[model samples]
Target: MHKQSVFSFISQLIWVYILLFSAVSFSQKLTSGFKHTNALINETSPYLLQHAHNLVNWQPWSEAAFEQAKSQNKLVIVSIGYSSCHWCHVMEEETFSQEDVAQVMNENFINIKVDREERPDVDQVYMTAVQLIQGRVGWPLNVIVLPNGKPLYGGTYQTKTDWIKLLNSLSKTYKEQPEKTTEFANRIAAGIQEKNEFGTEKGSVFFSKELLNTNITTLKENWDLTYGGLKGQQKFMLPANINFLLDYVILSNDAQAKKYIKLSLNNMALRGVYDHVEGGFFRYSVDTKWQLPHFEKMLYDNAQLLSVYANAYKVFKNPLYKERIEETYQFLNTIFKSKKR
Candidate 1:
């Protein structure tokens, strides 16, 4: 539960994740022998380039691709993720590269592979829709959209069987029940537009002390008191949640909330979610205990987490929080230095 001690304890387990990361890169390289290639071959993005050899005819997000979809009267498959995404790599290997899977996708849909880092605009639109439809979202985000680009269905990381079934079913539905598909797409479009719209209502919203307390109380109800982080099978280290709670604790001197935040921070830092070897956090844990990491080190997540840890160091002055901030700083600097070359 301390500085170097946590690293020493978890060092052995860290190598297993390191090996998995290495193997994904290695397998991606081996695809050179596969005869199929797509327009993604010409893309500069490392994430898009990774899918260049897939049998699926992947286009970088463009007017031309959408134009083709309009011309062909086909739905669009907008699959978005970045290079460091583990599920994206898994979906590429297990679903995209397959001959049969690619056949269906190529025949039925205009498949657009988006590097989320490069196209946060596109990601935001469909990501909001996915959250609206599924009430949850994560990468390797796969959405089926109308040719004009309204989403019909959105989900993440489908197995090859499920991917095929989904494409076939959606394709069939679009062809047979055109009115129904359009109506559904219209609803999703409305929800996305409404969610993205800034509330322009004139009057300033009043926040009473009682109302603020009620809001905090409602939030606390969702907290996983035992292991920390939100109550769910999966645990994401959402810096915003911690950032808000940290500020509230400082202002209100809320002992109970402070204790819970400390517990959350401690568990997050010491658990498998934080890379013991690499000095950055993974995207999330597959389990609530923060022991089963999803194995993708997202820069945005790590950068925001750095702010959370540093601010916590200001308040708690915990040496462990300071250590995490230092480690994450070093990790980010190393990444930047490499990119500079």
Candidate 2:
């Protein structure tokens, strides 16, 4: 062979060696008895990076995933979770890591994992569905949907065996009971559509002065003065509602409403739900006393509550409320600034 032919042969040999070495390296890196064809390597998200080598042929939440599911007539299994959640990690190891479970999921459904912390809007919509379906919701929420993104069924985490059984059952149901599936999906879709369309009409209707006063009176009647927040075991620091109360107090010269607003803000700021160390509020309290929190501190919640505290300081001339507002701002600047992208 001439010099040029020898060089060409050498280049071809090098390419073949590179390909074979890469295949061996990949095989060695994968967990025993689990192999997948995912192309999500080097992704930055901690949650997505964790699943980069999962046994399931996972696709990112994309138009392609939905389109493929539609073309294949497959149900879309949307698994929503966050990185820090312990149960989310457990479910991944137990079910998503199993080769057989992954095979069933890949074959029968379009599995899509969503990082709830990354895309809260998606989480909120499906979480609402899960709540509607089961009358409660939690992390690692799972929803099964039709090709058009209409949720057909929803629940929380399942063990490997249970998930496999559920997948098998759902696959059979989808294949054999098409009309029944469509009927269930349509009912949910119509209900959700109507709820979304009508849910905000209350504010529109109660825009009048007398209606507003009446609503304020009704809300104050249920206020938990002893606990210093709204009346509930699951206490949410509803800043909007608080602001409405403040407005009512100012307009109607209601001393009780103003007193309730101050008490609620002070109690929430002093409670464990406020993240005294970190200086941002948790999602909400699980108990009536505002002691135990759900522990997911969201950006929007912190921003809104920060403003509320700042306004409270302006109204009451309280240094503690002003300090809380500054601390919340600092927390946002430190944590959220890093995660903005």
Candidate 3:
């Protein structure tokens, strides 16, 4: 009886020690040194607040940030993203949180973080710049701009090593080749501000079935014959492309186009791009076979896909298309209901 009592006493003492140690460790973490917050600390945006404690000295999208960049004569890095972007979170954790990366960015650039959801005007200008410069755009959109906010260079997510190297290279070039850099920035600014000239020439525009069929035939050359979408390693189920083809097939009664549409739809539904368990489609597939998804469920993509499948079922009467339509409707309804809750 005495030995049992002694064992219980010792167990209680060990538990007390563990609790005390945990408390001390937590307290030390809280008070060891004051963790610095950036200019995003006071922002009401959820996406901006996500980076409040980042070591990169991130500033909210403000005129003050631009003024500071002008005063310092440093290139401004405007990085844009939303709260739910997977790549944005990845860059935050892998690239922005690092001490060395923060050191270079803080010293050389006036870094600005923008929640694309909050300030779509800012997002639109830089997105246009990135698309014009790189021929494509995606988040987290990182654009290096002059003090006046004209984009110089832009890209999506970069690894820590590539990011640091690019920053150093750009800073060096900007410092040593200021004239050339300004000229390039001016050219990009012109491109962004350039108006669309297509179909603006003074001429009588003519539309004919032959021209439409010819264009469709040319577009088919880009389609993947084997796996069924556009010939690319990464496939985005762009519903616009699919819907246009569907319209053509319906009006023209083109047998080959109908076959291609069925092939593409079947592969998309069967592949990993469509979540068999979850009843929604992924944003895109990383592989040509559509066997691997990027795993970001975008509501817009799924909604468009639902419409495409519904229209497809009306024409093809494929039971799979009908099933997918019902499933996707349920998925969207569930999401909306949850948001209300």
Return the lDDT, model 3, position 309: 95
lDDT of 3 by residue, 55-101 (tens): 99999888999999999999999999999999999999999999999
Off by over 4 Å in 1: 1-32, 339-341
In candidate 3 the C-alpha lDDT for residue 312 amounts to 93
Of 1 and 3, the candidate ahead on lDDT is 1
The regions of model 3 sitting more than 4 angstroms off are 1-34, 195-211
lDDT of candidate 1 vs native? Answer: 0.91
What would the per-residue lDDT of candidate 1 be over residues 160-249, giving only the tens digit for each residue? Answer: 999999899999999999999999999999998787775756789777989989999999999999999999889988899899999999
List pairs with backbone clashes in candidate 3. Answer: none
- In the range 55-134, model 2's lDDT, one tens digit per residue, is 88777778899999999999999988878776688888998888899899889999888888788888888887877778
lDDT of each: 0.91, 0.83, 0.90
Worst 10 residues of 3 by lDDT: 27-36
How well does candidate 2 match the true structure, expressed as C-alpha RMSD? Answer: 5.0
Better of 2 and 3 by TM-score: 3
